[model samples]
Target chain A: MIGFISEKLTGYLLKRETICQEEYEIYLFGMAQFFRKILVDATVVFLGILFGKAWEMIIFLIAFRVIRIYAGGYHAVTPFGCYLLTILMLFMVLLSLHFISWNLSILTAVWIFASVLILALAPIEVENRPIEEAERIYYKRKVRVFWILENIAILLCMVLHLRMGAESIVLAQATLGMALLCEKWIHGDVRND
Target chain B: MRKGVVKMVLKKVAYHEAEKSAKIICGWFFYQPKLPNAVKKLRKF
Candidate 1:
């Protein structure tokens, strides 16, 4: 629904003759995506306020963004699907916040488990927009490095008694692992159609 | 005046394809910042 509106407004305003169809396509798509993102953020933040943890959600959002930059997760195929995934992920993070007091061993175990899955699936790419071969290799390595640093940052937060930060990182990584596994199951990483 | 169903359908498909194409060209594994150079490299136009 949002995509329909955003696209029509953009198409009506954009001078298609001045620019090529590809450019028009890109602009319309970007606008729809931007609207989708806004909707997700608004809904999540509203839910956070309702739960009386709006600030905590902000931290979780930041951590999720940082981890997501390098750790590829499932990308829903459509706007509605994206909204659903975002909502589910946000609630999952909020629910996981209760694990702040998890025993060191258990948290470490979960971290290790999540790390294995993410490293296994980092740098996953789309088929239609395939990256250059060399860039793919470089990005894969960088993702691994970033994952390690992210884990270390989580540990540091825990040690410093930043419970919210720690739990946010934990949620982010665990969600990443879950997303990768689910995406692989539904659409194998190699066979993205 | 009634809006034709076919016209609405045509607009929906056009927008959907436009969005889908942009998404395809941009890639979808991770959300990287859309830097100008990256956009240039991704889009031939």
Candidate 2:
């Protein structure tokens, strides 16, 4: 029943008229909701790992799966640039945590949660104009930023893997692939537009 | 009246296409088309 409602809402929101006049508040609210959802999922995963609770891992996976669907279905999905930024931030925290001795994993988890909160509450403006030029430029800049952050995150993860012989690099790739696949599924093709 | 509205939409679409083409051409020369001006022209038409 909830799925049906979500599908309907997704359809309604993706329709042209429904998107023509979105207010800034609406965009902010949407972004906040998206970020909140991600934070909850990440917390679940982190806590699950900390407590060695298999159930929490299951719950985290389910939560991310839902996020994947939601993002793909909604045209107002979380911007890739922001997603990449969050991933890079997570990578940095994880790497830095390795150098510290005092329950650094907990600190990394906290950092991830805090970053999620900050992104959720960040002041961002969306130009909801109908002009293609403005939209194109906006997306172009966004894609560029995403590209840079993604590359840096990937590189850092690889570096850490080389130094520590950890599987975190593979985990990063899997996570990134899932995100890209989800985005592609939602957007009907992932080749930039 | 609905037909007129459709025609207006089509006109705007055409304007957008032309503007995109102009931008592409300008991009080859390391320039960007004036988007605000293009949008203004579109409104004028």
Listed in order, each prediction's TM-score against the native is 0.70, 0.28
Q: Candidate 1: where are CA atoms >4 Å away?
A: A15-22, A99-101, A127-129, A191-193, B1-45
**Model 2 residue B43 lDDT?**
34
lDDT of 2: 0.35
RMSD vs true structure, all candidates: 8.1, 16.6
Runs with alpha carbons beyond 4 Å of true place in candidate 2: A1-35, A38-42, A45-48, A51-133, A160-173, A182-193, B1-45
- Give the lDDT of residue A33 in candidate 2: 33
lDDT of 1: 0.60
Over A1-193, each residue of candidate 2 has an lDDT whose tens digit, in order, gives 3224333433444353433332222322233333344554575456446645434244324422322221221123233434444444344435443454424364345335433432232111122222344534544454345434533543564466432212232233234334444334554432234
Best by DockQ: 1
State in Å the error of residue A173, model 2: 4.7
Cα lDDT listed for each candidate: 0.60, 0.35
DockQ of each: 0.08, 0.03
